[model samples]
Target: MKLGLKIKTAREEKGLTQNDLVKISGVSRASLQLYEADKGNITLDNLEKIANALDYEVVHFLSSNVVPQSKKTCPPICPSIEKNMSPNMSLNNICEFIENDSPLPPTQSNNSVRIPVYDEVYASAGQGFINDEHITQHIELDKGFLRSYFGLTSFLDLSIITARGDSMLPAVPENCQIIVQKGTPREGQICVTRIDDELYVKRLQKRPKYKLISDNKSYDDIELEGENYEILGIVVGLFQKIP
Candidate 1:
């Protein structure tokens, strides 16, 4: 039987309804339905919880006898290339693989590419001295280039920058690649800011007065009004590079 059918059988044997499983498992009602229907991926943690609730070993719930469907085949590898290439190849080698596979050049398209920039500065960087005129070389990019560079949506005008300080850590960590969109700040959006000649990244909390909050507990919140700050751009995503 399929995974979904197995789950349904198990639930029915236990005399439990989807709502009852939802309450017991602390999973949402929709998610419980998906689990029983086998329409969604269940984490190992959730699977364990479900097994415990149903009084079964985790493996017992799976269809061990069922065989998975076979995948479609691809072309055979080039023996010459395979023999010459190392098991551990660099990014350049991977790009060369793409180049060899297709007739198109890599740089033909203008897409947004993730470029590493300086880390954000907070605390010591005053609002009065923040400078927007900081000269930096920005390369024009295409969607594919941008997506490959930052590992983000290829169609969006997005680029990644590393966070320099711990002010936004836990949520936005230091040295994390923060995805930025060049646009006006919406209310309650996370953004990069320049104030008093210094640059910082914080979530923009607009109440009766504007406030900037750091995700890290060590950093204090900042309040600004009038000319104290300017929104550089809104932050849409973030990621960390594993060494």
Candidate 2:
């Protein structure tokens, strides 16, 4: 059942109207209405308010009809999640327990932080080629490796983009994976940006419009007229793939 219907059902079972719920929960009427309409997601705090008002626990909604990934349906991970677990238990219970108890066991499996690797776009590190934007996959890189190699403090601010062509050359090599961060750059800072639907890793200069520059002398600077460009991310660190 939709979360909204569940909330509405519980509230009606408790003999509470929307006005009564808003008065008891201290949540705004519009927000309560949105929750009932199933328009969007709500925070745990707000969920607690509504759940308490309806005399039901938050997990009741979850465990009642929760399926993170169904075995006969969409579970590449669910089927192998917990083989020895009870059949009566649903995925929702596991999640509910995890939620109530913060900080899951820090397994070595999840110790390495994950960063998204984009296959479609390439920074012009070698020769120039245009590609579409897509996230090919994600890899859990060792936090120690990231810290040692890039002096990075947080994985939350990092992503991996493959470099293709050599417009960046000596500074950025061709066919390398570069770490990117979304941040406002100083003028002349090397950044990963997009123009005309093509992604590029280039030095940026701000004028009335934007100017994308290449480190290699062979490629001329591309003047981006009007608002036809976007700053995707700044190059933080670079790595080579071992064949």
Candidate 3:
């Protein structure tokens, strides 16, 4: 039987509706529907929660069930990837990759093929900054090239933002490659931020008030607030191509 069918059967046998299982398992209504319908992939953590709530073991859940079915699914793909991906990637459109027998390529096997590039800051390092409304375009580098520098081949969870200005000079040049980690931004760390209507690559500092500081003293620092700005991602790694 399919995983979803098994989950649905287990739930019904225990006299639990989808509501009852969600309340007991803490899984979302949409996800529960997927689980019962065999729609998409479920992380190990979530599967564990459902198993515990349904009074079953992870072994039983996996050993007795099958993967999601292709086609005939509502909306055709699962929406689970939405929260974990950048604009260039579609959370619901990664099913073809899962079904493939081949291994993922270096830097991007399945979801790693595209790395998004945000705007450029020109004032830094004597380059011109360019902004685009449609900035979610991705860059595809050679698979072997990415493997040479990074141990992990997949850059699935990372995003690339541009350093347009020279504010982070000497360390990060203008038009520098700043790979942002997709999660909460930390203070005293380099972050790609959206300040109201504008985007910036700056270092976040909590000096009594929220503010972004520039490493290049020639440029001035700007004060910020949680409401006015959003942290796009954290600067996990920096890259530069050999010219």
How many Å off is the CA of 227 in candidate 3?
6.6
Clash count (model 2, backbone only): 6
Tens-digit lDDT track for model 1 on 145-169?
2344335453444444445566665
> With candidate 3 superimposed using the best TM-score fit, by how many Å does residue 233's alpha carbon deviate from the native?
0.8
TM-score of each: 0.41, 0.47, 0.41
Candidate 2 lDDT, 110-141, residue by residue in tens: 33665554432333442112222334334445
Candidate 3 CA-lDDT value? 0.53
Highest TM-score among the candidates is held by which one?
A: 2
Top candidate on lDDT is 2
Which model, 2 or 3, shows the larger lDDT?
A: 2
* Residue 50 C-alpha lDDT in model 3: 80
Candidate 2 Cα outliers beyond 4 Å, as residue runs: 1-111, 121-133, 207-209
List clashing residue pairs in candidate 2: 125-165, 125-166, 126-165, 126-166, 127-165, 127-166
CA-lDDT, candidates in order:
0.49, 0.58, 0.53
